[model samples]
Target chain A: MKTIGKDRFGKIIDKSYFPLLVVFALVTLIPVYILVKISISEPVDVLTQHPTFLIHNFTLEHWEKVLTSGRLWPAFTKSFVVATLTAIFAIFIATPASYVISRLPKKVKYIVILTLFFTRMFPNVGIALPISVKFIRWNLMDTYTGLVLAHLIEQLPFITWILVGTFEVIPVDLEKSAMIDGASRIRSLISIVIPIATPGIAVASLFVWLNSWNEFTYALYLSLSENTLPLQVYYYVNRGGFFQTATYATILTIPVALITYALQRYLKSDYLGGAIK
Target chain B: MKKFFQKYHLEILLILPLTLYIMYFTLLPVLTTINLGFINADTNVFSLENYEYLFGRDDFRKAFSNTVIISILGLIMQLTVGLILALILKKTFKGKGFFRALILTPMGVPTIVSGVALLYIFDTQGYLNELIYRVTEGLKYIGIIASSYKFIPIDWASGGIRTLFMIVFADMWKVTPIVTLLLLAGLESISLQVYEASQIDGASKWQTFKNITLPLLKPSITMTVIIRAVDLFRIFELPMILAGKNTPVIATFAFEEYRLYNNPNISGAAATILLVIIMIFVSLYLKYIDKGEGLA
Candidate 1:
């Protein structure tokens, strides 16, 4: 380690990097801190000509208002349900397809992977309009099925891409051995391959869920009557006062923060970096 | 036929559902959007009226330019900031993991939430103005300037180039972490022996990074550019939430046209234009990825 450090740039970097890192860290954190501060601060503190860096008057009135206002829970439940279903369906759909793709010949696999990349890059609003129009025709508007299906358009390719990488890393010999033991291919996949690929599957599902939860465009189109948490937060930001918007935004962020913290260890760059290699 | 069925039946069955779903849901909608873009909304006949109408509008033209300009500007900022941060974290240092995790917190925050948080930070009476006001006030007390000078807050949300800068800054804050992570992965893949070799050849730090690190990090940079370009081109929520309807990007323009103006054809036209731009990036990305060793 010492030799590695001494190889090129040692002393200048060692002395200077710490302060730079601190500045970067503060730049990332201060906005989040202000969000929480405003959520708890009195209106007088937030809407003033000279807002304090720290909370000047801490109060729970905004949170209390948001909670009892009967708006948060519906959107909360709708978002949670939609996100959970999107994750489940995305995993179910993507895992099998990815497993198959992973086993394909090199040329075929490359083409399939490219197709997935293409689909993944399609602008959400472009597709969202057509999907919304179709959903309305099918009488699926403002329904869970509609939003979940819409969310899956993006999540499917993304999750499949991640899971294909996951499935690739698992040795094919493990499945072949199970097949020799009289296990059917499907049974082997269920009992052997999936258990081994649990971590990757977990990562894929985590991302799908997070994407669905944070999704705005599809929800904006399909979810007309009942709002998702993100849509609700957007509404508040547009119409509500600073305190209320802060409270809603803070509420929306808590679950995301907790999930990311718990799963941060699983966030290998391999999931994204695998594409170039 | 029986043997082929027996050999590949499970694979076929496993892959069928997703293929079908994507065909109906994903492919169909994209085709529908393109088709709608080319059709007359009222007469239901094939026409270029929608595109013609969109092209004639000042707001649509502005949205088009804004999307292109902002996406490029934001990607540059994200890449530069991301690379700097990635380099800082590439070394072994005290509290490195803590700082890495800390920086990623913004990425985990929902995009809408980030927009709202940025609004609070950049608003007229927001934290940024307050900080500036205090700094200038202290300078005034030291007789560096006239005491009559008042600190007036700039309306960052108001539509202009300044608002565009706010959008880019907010996007950089929220997105640079992912870029950092991707570049860090690229950095990790570089062998330390390369640096050691360069040092023995008497290369300076800047030279080593310029020649060695930069060249080696190309694939990752390419990957980052593709992802950031695609995502930034469709930047919807931040600009909408920050600048309102006055400063429309292509995505917001489409949304406003559909929802506010009740013109799906025009909206589809704008969206199709965005799709065309994004597809250019996608193809470039695919070509780059194709040049690599095939995925396992």
Candidate 2:
């Protein structure tokens, strides 16, 4: 009869708990384990059932195939460059704007913030072709800059909301005291506000990087002959080489997995866009 | 004006550049889409012809219905499984941190990569059937089975409603964790004091959950449902990677219309419909997030 009470993990009511753990493990781990095993397994082993999930023979052949595929490095470079640039710009440009919006009067603030949320949520995937045509007219299509601009449309608005939440939590007194001590507004922002807001900024940056890195629909529209990491993975899978496809999938996944795990501490358990009070 | 600039100069410098960038990329594109959806390119006349053409097509009708069906099904699984998992996770347990990370690992993986991963599993001659075939063979080899028992493998990608279902499953695998994490935060925001007060009054677990947890979780519930529903509606890569371009879900349908058919009006019209559908969910989502109330 004990209710869920807050203790950080939140609550534990019953003395006996076995079933939920099993379900959790199966749902969370099984598919990933299968994917990893397939990626490293030999091509024959992948298609056959005998040595599945446990490697009888480990081979770097599939890894070699992906490494030498010629498309892989370019794809990797494209994704990394686009994603890193997107993260840097989103954090630098959006965070200050977010702080300003957060400082506004409540009615104007809600309107502005809500407008940001709507823009962030709605368009990135849906507006691909219309925007692609626009990019093409600018002769921006299929270029790295084109992809970045397309992705910024997707990345900036969402992280702006996230950073706004981040900035709102830094108290006015901290920055005010810095200003009162004759620090200029910009100096106070750099010296006082940014340092305190580091954690939220990091989480927001991780989000922007991951979103830009993994995004597909915009990359599909914006680029044609050249592929980003995600689109290249799709191309390989489309061509039907199981182990090679899995190898690329693994490569695509590793950084994201590392980033999520390393930055795990900062991810607040709310709406991802900081869609909360 | 100079005084005002002096007062808010920092905010202005901060906000202005990014605002212009957003206007160029997002706002301008949005206007162009609305424009393209209505106007004929050659005639330069705005009309409902694109929408009319879209609604008249059989494939568009199919895509619309399929989008509706998949969204509803995916939404149900996400909310139910998410709530249950969040409840399990809210409790303290052994290896809790590890388990939390494991559940959320999918969030970090590129959605396209997840599509590839699941395709490797679900393909006709893929690991799934191989596993099924070998399991029965192993039983036969061990002599624990009668000779009469047989197993046949499923051809999952044979292109039907089942293929659509497979895409839905793939999406659920990738996305359900997000919903769980959202609800977990909502549960975390509920105070220990409330539960303790209820306990003092001797409410049973089910009664307390119904009275306290459910009502308290409404905003999170609404937020998760709308977010996940719109996300599911806009699904592209899962079907594209798993089922190929022929599968006519709304997103891919729009893609096929533009890329394969080379018809901008039809694609624009389809994209506009998707925009309307998403806005409905966005409006609902804004209502809940705006309440900014108990659910965090």
Candidate 3:
């Protein structure tokens, strides 16, 4: 019986999980491959055929067209600027607020959490009408600052709630230890709590960044002049002519796909506490 | 007073900006909605004329029905499919990790992209029809789906309410993985010992699932449903893109009133109604959550 138990444990450890994992791994790679192939393959080839496992020929014509067409750079800049600014804003706004929530009395904490959940649940469209009207009145429409503010409607609660989870995971003992050492609350938060919660911070920043970057609904309606990369890609997909538009779209997806892939690790993990487990 | 000043100063500082932002953005918007619901745009005086106007309109009633039908259908599709996929993927299987990542791909694609992609696949000359045609032709000899040869090529994009189904399907394709992931998280917390004990008691598969799994999963199921319902309720881009401005989800309808008609008040009225509904649902969901924790 002991030998059987030991053997079972050994089998659990030594069984070739990698071979089992390969099929699923291929499934993930298939879409990435299709997108890349579509981006590089000849327009004729793209139009005449469906996506296959392998490509017959490659062309850099699409990349050339995308670069020379001149919308790519501005769109890229818009997306980057929006994402970076939104991340910074969300993190800065959320950190202190979440910290306060963490320190509040239990009843207050529950109320605040509930409030956050409810407000976050408020569809962007609900406030979107009134908010956009206000933006237009204030001449904030079609601006980066305007888009950033609009994003906050969604980003604020997400960042705060996520950070709250991170803050909660850290025991009070750590903060008390810092207080005993004569460190100020702010000092402890900055020096000890923040460092320890770096992964959580990364997770929060990642969510904010991806959300702002990939967001289409507000960006579509709000930004009239400096269209974000997603807007440009979408415009091409819907409005631009066959080959040129497809090529532009294919070019557009590369950065987003990369960013998404990079952040897949955090996404895979249960970073937010509200997730079922 | 000095001690109070010292102790609460940080709290005041921390909360003030957030409060101000929320007040100006969230609270004010909701209030604006309520205020708008009370007054007519032309009169600029306080009245229930806007509400009466909304309540009286035939299209408004249709829109409400459509929205509810779509939301409920979308929720049911998402939950049922999501739960099944979650269960299927929970057990470790060959290539499970990679398939898991593949399943999550839809989430990474933006909503607008999803709208366009589904449009591409399901349009008349699209891949779906082509596949169906080929399959039907091949299957006719096998006596499967007897009207296989007579199958009409359905143009999904132009199919009014049917397009809503496509929109729901597209959304499900994107969000079901999220639901599955959430339920999978719930599943993770349920120890294998429970299942083992159920098995030892000679419980059948269905019985074990009903008895052991469903009860334990109620909280997570509730969370997923409530969150996803709220998410679907405020849906704008998917239906908007697929069905155009004609598709009247609450959010899109609000957008039209504010943007196209230049009638913020009407938009506000609609939004106010939506806001109250969502808040009520959210409060109930939270109450349940609290109760589950014995906190209420």
User: RMSDs, each prediction?
Assistant: 2.9, 4.0, 5.4
Binned by DockQ into CAPRI classes (incorrect, acceptable, medium, high), candidate 3 is: acceptable
Candidate 3 local lDDT, B123-166, one digit each (tens): 56555666677678778867776753565677777746777787
Considering TM-score, which of the candidate structures 1 and 2 is the better prediction for this target?
A: 1
User: Global lDDT of each model?
Assistant: 0.86, 0.79, 0.72
Second chain alone, TM-score for each candidate: 0.93, 0.87, 0.90
lDDT of 3 by residue, A163-199 (tens): 8778887988998899999999889888988899888
Candidate 2's residue-wise lDDT over A133-241, tens digit each? 7778999877888888788887888888887777777899998999999998889988998899898888888888998999899998888888898888888777877
Positional deviation of residue A79's Cα in model 2 after best superposition, in angstroms:
1.2
lDDT of 3 at A118: 69
lDDT of 1 by residue, A103-166 (tens): 9998899898878877877778888998888888999888888889889998898899888888
Which residue runs does candidate 3 get wrong by more than 4 Å?
A1-63, A237-253, A268-277, B1-3, B55-59, B140-151, B280-296
Q: List, residue by residue over B200-282, the lDDT tens digit for candidate 2.
A: 88676777788999988887787677678768888888888988754678889888878777877777778888889888766
TM-score of chain B of 1: 0.93
lDDT of 1 at A221: 89
DockQ leaderboard ranking: 1, 2, 3
Per-residue lDDT, model 1, residue A244, is: 81
